[model samples]
Target: MQVIDADTVARATPFERLVPALRELFASGAEVPPRQVLTLADPAGGAAVTSLVMSAWDPGRYYAVKVINIAPGNAERGLPGLHASVLLHDAITGVPLALMDGDAITTRRTAAASALAASWLAPADAREMLVVGAGRVAALLPAAYRAVRPIERVTVWARRPEAAEVLASRWRSDGFAVTVATDLANAARHALIVSCATLATAPVVRGAWLAPGSHLDLIGSFTPAMREADDACFRGASVWVDTEEALVKAGELLAPMASGAWRSADLRGTLAQLARGEVHGRSAADERTVFKSVGTALEDLAAAMLVQAAAG
Candidate 1:
């Protein structure tokens, strides 16, 4: 099988193309079973580690499996917190096609999915963005969101101020009006789009800070123990998700339900419904929207297929 490195994946899946590709992938269908997750206790008495296995297939075409490990303590060592590998196969022939960098695929596809959702949910004139973290995914969000909206300015807020400043500098170099935000609440209040990709177990974004017509993209929380936004963020917002899995796996949704602040019935729709025009998104100019994503294998498969095709 051929090996596709991270750089190859990055070159193949630019946000301008990947965003529309993801929208098409969701509109069409793929078989994606629930992701398998295992929480591992650290023998060294450190933060718990998480292992995830996700697979998806398009019948008679391609199949992809992604294995990911999330080490929360990696940040202290200045290493990426998430590492992943993806394997692609020809479903019709049952032949292995490629082994791709899942970390790159995951980051790009996740950002693209958020941008796809924003195409329908974010205000037509949205420009200012508040990025809640400075991790790998956060670095690509502006590029992805810019594919759909005119994102001219960015405000970065992170637990580590230095990291946020570093990320801001990179954006500024790219010609964006960027700033490091010491006050998250103040930044969030003025941002037209608030995209959060953090691994915090506690709520970081509060609902009261969000202004009308804001689009909140919550990408960090995947497991039941992780949360980025609080329960109040769900109140009075048109909530959507990448898939139904967010209801069961993400604490962003689970915690709100447990506290009687939101219910599954309150959700507007999934990405598929929006892509297929089965649901109304941002009907009013003043409406607030939320897109909560717990990553799905279908997105990975779609990204892998794109990479494989580009390699050929």
Candidate 2:
């Protein structure tokens, strides 16, 4: 098997390439099985260990398996809280083809997916962007948003005000108008809002605070017990997801569904429908659009395919 490091993966897959690949993978007629998650908890540290396994097949073209480990406190030491690796194999022969850095693949594919969703769901004239959380994903949001919208102003909010300011400064140096917001409500008032934090139990942005013609992308909260958006958020907007199966299991849609404010049918459609033109997106200029992403195996498989091809 060819070993691929993070830098190699970054060089191999670009956001532009991954976005369309993901769009096509979802739009194409294919089958991807649900992911399996195994969890281990530490009562003393008040944390849990999670291992995720995802598999997908585009039938005769490719197949892949991504395994990820999640430990919440690893971020305290300046390391990513989540780590992952992916294995690509020949569909016909079952031979191991490539081993890739799953963390980089995950972030890139996720940002690309969010950007793709924004392209269809957000207004074409969108000019402002707000991102929650100052982690690696937060740093990538602006580039992803700019790919889809005409984002002129970028605002960032995190539990640590200093970290928010730091990220804002970095973005400013990169030639974008960036600011740090003390209140998440103030951040939510932007034209496009991206949530990338790892808070497990609290809602950061309130649905009432969202402006009309706004696009919200919730990329955190990968488990049923975690929620970034409140029930009212779902009630106030048209909800779209990467996949209905993944969303129903663990996504921003979970909490609202659990609270009785929303139902499974409330989901207007999936990214595949939107991309394939089967479903309408942002019917009106003033419509509130929310895209809830729980991440997907097909996205990883698609991205890994691109990376592997580029590596060769």
Candidate 3:
């Protein structure tokens, strides 16, 4: 079996290609079982860790499984919080084909999936953006959204002011008009698209702060305990999700439902429905839109296949 590294995966899947590939994959469909998310006690007596196992397969072709470990405390140590690996196998023979660096696949595919959702939901002239995190995934969001929207200006906000400045400087060096925002709510009010990628148990982006016609991308919260946007963010907004699993797993959605501020019937549709033309997106110029992603196994499989093809 071949071993595919992060650099190889990055080279294989760019947003321009991966976004459309994800669109196609969602349109055509695959067999994906509900992913397993388990909380484990840290043997070192630090913060609790999460283990995620996601699996997906295409008939007669391939099967892929991604194993990811998330340690929130790693950020304090100046290290990445996510460590992941993907194993691909031949469906018929059940033979292992490759082992891939899942972190690269996860970040790219996650960003690409957000971009895919934006293609349908974001306003036609969205150029300014507010990024609500300063992590590995947050760094890629600007480029990903730019693929679909005209994104000209970017503002980054984080709990750590210095970290936000570091990300802003990097984006500035890349020729983007970037700024480090000390006030997140003010930034969200003025931006055309607000993309959040934080791992927060509490709400970071409030609904009242979002301007009309703005697009909100929530990528951080995956468990029932994790939430990035408050219940008001969902009120009266046309909401879409990457998959149906988010209904039960995402706190951003669950909290509102529990509070009677939102209902499951209010959901506009899934990304697949949008891709398949079964649902409409951004029906009005001044409509508020939200796309909540909890990650999906099909995306991991799509990204892994792209890397495998590129490596071969």
C-alpha TM-score for every candidate: 0.93, 0.90, 0.93
Candidate 3, residues 24-80, lDDT tens digits: the string is 889989999988879999788999889999999987988999999998999989988
Residues 1-312 of candidate 2 have per-residue lDDT tens digits of: 999998998887777677788888878845678788899787877568798899887788778899999988777768778889999998888889999999888888888888889888888887878888887777778877777778788888898898888898889987799878887776686545555555556787788888887888888776677778778887868888888775656646767777788888778898889888899788888788888887888888989999988987
**Candidate 2: clashing residue pairs, number:** 0
> TM-score for model 2?
0.90
147-239 per-residue lDDT for model 1 (tens digits) = 999999999999999999899999998889998899999999998899999989999999999999899999999889999998889988889
Q: Where is model 2 more than 4 Å wrong at Cα?
A: 39-49, 71-81, 194-196
In candidate 3, position 142 carries an lDDT of 90
Pairwise TM-score winner, candidates 1 and 2: 1
